[model samples]
Every structure is written in structure tokens, then in C-alpha cells.
Target: MPPQQALAIARAFLPKRPWGNRYDYYYTRAKLRTDPLYPGVLAALRDTPGPVLDLGCGLGLLAHALHVDGQPRAYYGVDIDASKIERARQIARRTGLKDARFEVVDLGARWPEHTGNVAILDMLQYLPSQVQAGMLAHVSRMLAPGNKLVIRSALGDDSGRGRTSKVTDLMAHFAGWMQEVPKSYPTRESLEGHLANAGLSATFSPLYGNTPFNNWLIVAERRAG
Candidate 1:
């Protein structure tokens, strides 16, 4: 997203309260401008069908990005944080973003009933390895023909970039930006094996545009009959 467009989107998230509005504004702006996550996701989802189920959606930034990009898919964003969910709802309602909804749900315990494309971004490392495998299997099973499962995660590796990602994630946990320290990161082989076992073919590519984190974009779809 361009700086001006990111600024415009950030303005929509401005809270009515005086205390934390600045944080929301700047954080949203910075994430939008600097992070390549949204652009990568938006491109991956462009040809897929609606609606989209975004697991671990923080403050519904994807919803806003879709709205800005003129993708009219019905977006259902869920996260474990109640406060962020409420704030996302507020932003959607205030901005009149059609077909966007937000909810709070513990993904480790249960996933909402959804049938469409799915997005899991920057969240898989927080769960235990078994949970991550289970979640990937569940998510892969939800994919119908022509639908897609898009994910952005830091793949586990021995490289310096991988170490940087781990350190940054730890700092996020310490700063209270995340509820848990990252438990496990899935290696490329593990992720591919899990998805292959679930009957989906996947493609992986580097998503680290300007950021130093070891992020990779994985797009999976069911094989055609």
C-alpha cells in the first residue's frame, strides 16, 4: 500500500476515545506502509472466491485492505483478543465497510463455522507444534474446489533471518503485543508435509519485502477432480 493510502486506512481506525487513538493510528499506518503481509495476501486472494475467513485477524486490517482495494468479499475476521475484536467491529461500523464482521474466538479450542477462502497470517508460531499441525489439517479440509488457503508465517530455519524473526517475536511477547511467546515454528518440510497429508497442493514464496523477518507466503488449493 502507498503511504497516502495507508494513511487513509489508518484514519478510519481512529478511536473516539482520546487515550489510545494515537497508538492505533500510528501502528496501523506503520503496519500498512511497511509490512508486505497485506499486499501479498491481497494478491493471493484476488482470484479466489468469497467469503474469506481470516483466522487471527488483528484489528481487521485485512478487512480494511480488502475494502480499500475494492474486493467486495464478505470478510469474517476472528481473533482471540476481545478488545481487538471490539475495536475492529467499531472500525468497520464507523467506516461503513460492507460485508465485514469481527468476532473473538480461541482458535486452539474451536474454529467458527466457515466455508470459503481462509487466511492465517503471522500467527501459526504461537501455537504448539501439534496444535499447528492440527489447525493446518482442519483449515486444509475446509477448502472446497476453487477456494484457497493463504498463510504467511516465519518458517523455521538455521539462518540469521530466522533467528531475527525469533528474537522479534520474543520482543513482541515481552511488550505485551502477543499473549504468548512463540511456542514453535514450522519448517518448510513440515508445513508442506502437513498440507500434502491434508490433500492440498501448496506453493511457497518469500514475503519479506522490506522487513527483516523470515516470512514466507504459502498458498494452497485442492486438486481438481
Candidate 2:
């Protein structure tokens, strides 16, 4: 790997330093090299024709990469921590990225206000249940029908009555910060329902094994005009 990429890979696994608060530090790093699905992420964003809003964007690496490819006209990252935002700013400046921007805001405190393309990577679970649904519904209102939402979240397995539910709940309880992730554990039926409820038609990609936890990538398009 090249020097910067090498640094990013090295930094990816560093025990979280005490510099920034928890989410900011981790999310920032995730934006850099933590996301192993960058090929898919790049493919999803490459064709988007509007300004991209990376909700809960940590260090802005995803957005920065998109900008370097000369794809998005503008890429904006909003996070709940200012320390991470400062770190993101530094990354932008060092890379000489101009079309990207970062904002300090707790999106869970309120729905993010942005139109066109959107990305919420492993951030849905961070919001309370109602907030997760509300954010999707809110985005439903903001984005046109042709727009897409790429969501990466944990799946809860609610297969057979009490047994699965208990297991799912146990997973959530132990997931800590990851608890917000739906404990369904990547079942198509459950994920499809979430998309259907949000007024989207969805297709899913199963990403499992060799990763920290089970995850599903939902690529959904708004169903109503």
C-alpha cells in the first residue's frame, strides 16, 4: 500500500486514543480504513448526481475519497462531536479537499436536513428506535423517489418466537455502543420489512464472516414520488 493508505490501515486498529470522545474517534477511523466494503461504497456513491450527505460521518475519509475521484460536487459530513470534526477538518486540509465540509451536530437530536444522496453507515442503531424510524420517514419526505439510501446496520434474528427473540436481545444487550443495531442479525425478512415500512423497495447484500460482527447492506430506493 502507499504511504497514506498504509498509515490509514495502521491507524484503523489503534486502540482508541483519549484525544476525541468515543464515537467521534471510532467513527472517524471507520471513515478512513475501517470500512472493508470501500469498493461497494465507492460504487454506490460514484453515480450519485447530488451533494452527498454522510450522516454521522466521522473523520470524513469516505467523503474525501469520493471528492478525490471528482465525483460528488459537494460532500458534507455531520457528526455529534466537535473534536472529531476538527480531526476531519485537518484531513480535508491536508488532502486539499475543497468540496467537502463537516458540521458538529447530534443528528439523533434532530433529523438531518439534506437532500439528494445520503449515507448512514452503521449509524442507524446509534439512534433510539423511534429516531431510527423517524429519520427514515423524514428522509422519505426529503428525498425524491429516485434517490437511494445505503444503510449498513446489524441484523436481529427474530425467526421462531421466543428463542430467537431472546438471542437477539442478548446480542443487542452485549453489543454496547453496537446495541442500537437491530438484533435481528441480518435476516432478509426483517431488513426487507424495515425498507418496506420506510416506503422503499430494497435489495440486500449479505456481508458476513471475517468481520467483527454480522452486517447487512441495504440499498434501497424511495418507493413513492
Candidate 3:
């Protein structure tokens, strides 16, 4: 999405009161302009069918992006932050986005019952390795043949970009954007192994566009038996 287009979307997030709305507006603008996460996820989900269950969806940006891009898929976004969820709901309602919903749910504790494509973006590192593994397994089960499970995360490594991602996440925690400090970052090998164990194949690609983070987009698919 271009900066001018992103500016238009950020307008939807602007709150009624100017007190805290500026933060959301600027954050959404910066994220949409600088991060390539939304476009990448949209491309991965383009040909897929059925509703989308977006785990760890913050402020439901993906839903908004999907609506803007004319995907027309039902978007159910869940996150642990109630405030963010509420704001997402309000935006969706105000924008008259059809079939878009948001809910506050602790992803580490439970997942909503869903059967379709799944997306876990930029939130896996906050969960422990075991929790992340379990979540992957559950997502794998939910995915029907030919459906996708898309994930965007910073793969763990010793490179400068990897270190930068770690530090950035920590700063987000300290800055109150994230309530939990990142516990573990998954490596490419580990994520591939987990998907394979669940009878899925994954393709990983760099998603860092004009950014210094080590983010990668992993698109996993369940083949027909």
C-alpha cells in the first residue's frame, strides 16, 4: 500500500476524541507505510477460499486491508488486548465492513473454534516455544486441504537483522505497545519441521520491505490426501 493510500486507511482509526486518537492514527500510518506485512499476507491469501481466522490480530488492520483490497472474505480477528479489539470493532462498524469481527481472546490459553485459513502475524515470538508449537498444531488441524496457514515472524538467528528484531520487540514491550516480552523466536528449520509433522508444506520468504527487522512470511498449505 502506498503512503497516500495508507494515510486514508489511517483516517478510519482516528478516534472521536483527539486525546488518544493521534497515537492510533500515526501508528497505523507508519505501520502501513513502512511495513510490507499487509500486502504480503494479502498475496498469500489471495486465491484461498473461506473465512479467515486472524490470530493475534491487533487493531484488525488485516481485515481493513482485506476490505480495501476487495477480498470480500469474512474476517474474524482475535487478540488478547480488549482495548484494541474494541477499537477494531468500532472501526469495522463505522467503515461498514461486512462480515468483519473482532474479539479479545488469550491465544496462549485458547483458540476460537474455526475451520478455514489462519493467519498468525508478528506475534509468535511472544509465546514460548512449546506454546508456539501447540498453536501450530491446532492451526494445522483447522486447515482443510488446500487452505493456508500464513505466519509472519522474525526467524531466530545470529545475524545483525535478527538481533535488531529482538531489540525492537523489547522496546515495544517497554513502550507499552506489547504487554508480554518476547520469549522465543522460531527458526526456519523449527517452523518447517513443525508444519511437516502436521502434514503441511511451507514456503518462507523475506517480508521486510524498507525495514531493518528480520521478518519472514511463511505460507503453509495442507495438500490433498
Candidate 4:
């Protein structure tokens, strides 16, 4: 199915807010339509035959898209934002997407116990440097052979595109949308090193789409010993 159709179906699961909080709906549509990350995520999970544990999942948008696309993998999404979790739960309840679950979770304190495909999308930058490594370590241990961990994050480069992403993140933080200010972004090499330390092989790709953000997707898979 084309991404547009999948996105349309996903939006159908969300409540209509033509007047109140309309920005969320508009943002959702624009994101699902323009951001390459959503399609990239679906492709990453296509062959991974297990439940998806999404860390820092915002509004469980990916879960909705998966459900719309008829992917049968059960989904468990965790985020630190209570409001987003509530919104996700409401969508699930309204749409009757029983396979999807969302919860308010502090990833720094405790990681959920699950094994399968994992996703950390546009979220790692919000974590402190130490917590980011620890979280990566925990996720690595959770995966067995054939399990993949997909991460989409902006790269830290001293370039114009890098600055663009950084500025956007800062604005988001200032607007109170992001709970914590982004402390740092990892270089591709550094991220790969982290994946290697976790016993995973990484495949990196530019996922900026038509945007100027220095975003990349790292699909790290644990191989059989």
C-alpha cells in the first residue's frame, strides 16, 4: 500500500479536532505525510517477527500507522509525557486497537522488559549523555538474534543542516513541548560504536527526506551467535 493510504487510515483512528487543539491533528498529518521516518520504520519492522517495543513513543503514532497497514505485530509504546500517553490511550480506545498499548514511562529510571523490534525515534537527543548510553545498553541486552533496534535521530555535525535540527529542537523545548532540552546529538560513528558494543551490526541511511534536518536512521540487528 502507498504511504498516503496508510497515513489516511492512521488519521482515521484519531479523533477529529477541527477547532480545539487542531494543531496536533495538522501536525500529525504533516508529519505522517512528509516525514520519511514513518515509512522507514515500517520497512524496518517488516521482517522482524516479534512485538515492537517503542521507547519514547509520542502519541503512539507509529502504532496507529502499523495497525492501519494491517501489521499484526503487537505494539507497546512508552513515553515520558503523560499527556501524549493519554492521547495515545484515547485513540486506542476509540479505535479499538487492542494490539497497541501506551504508557507513561521514565526510560532513564527503568526500561520495560520486552523482546522483539524496538524503535527510538527523535527521542534520544532529549536524554542526558550518560542516560543515553545506559538506555542503549539496556535495549541491546533485550534483543536476541534476529531482533532489530531502529533508531532515528539527528546527527551532531558542525554544519548548516545540523544547526537547523538543533534550532528546531531548541524551539520545541522552549515551547514546552519537549520535556528536557537536548543535551547532545551523536555522530554516526559514535552511534555505530554504541550499537557494536551492544552486539549489533548497524546499517545507516540518510532519512532527512525533503527537510533540512540532519536526521538519520540506524537499523541495528543482532545476529545469531
1 or 2, which is superior by lDDT? 1
Model 2 per-residue lDDT tens digits across residues 102-151: 99887768766888877877666566666666677776665655666877
Instruction: Work out how many backbone clashes candidate 2 has.
Output: 9
Question: What are the root-mean-square deviations of the candidates from the true structure over C-alphas?
Answer: 1.3, 5.7, 1.2, 1.9
Residue-wise C-alpha lDDT for candidate 3, range 1-225, written one tens digit per residue: 877778878999887876764888889999998899988999899999888999999999988888777789888999998988998899889888869988899878987888999999999997888888888888888897678999999999999999999999999999998887888899988888888877788899998899999999999988567
Model 2 scores a C-alpha lDDT of: 0.63
Better of 2 and 4 by lDDT: 4
Q: What is the lDDT of candidate 1?
A: 0.89
Question: Candidate 1 at residue 21, lDDT?
Answer: 46
Model 2: per-residue Cα lDDT at residue 71 = 69
- Across 88-182, the per-residue lDDT of candidate 1 in tens digits comes to 89889898986898889988788777888999999888788888888878887778789999999999999988999999999988999778678
Our tally of clashes for model 1 stands at: 0
What are the TM-scores, per candidate, against the unseen true structure?
0.96, 0.70, 0.96, 0.92
Q: What is the Cα-based lDDT of residue 206 in candidate 3?
A: 94
TM-score of 3: 0.96
Higher lDDT: candidate 3 or 4? 3
* Model 3: residues with Cα > 4 Å off, grouped in runs: 18-20
Query: What value does the lDDT take at residue 150 in candidate 1?
Result: 94
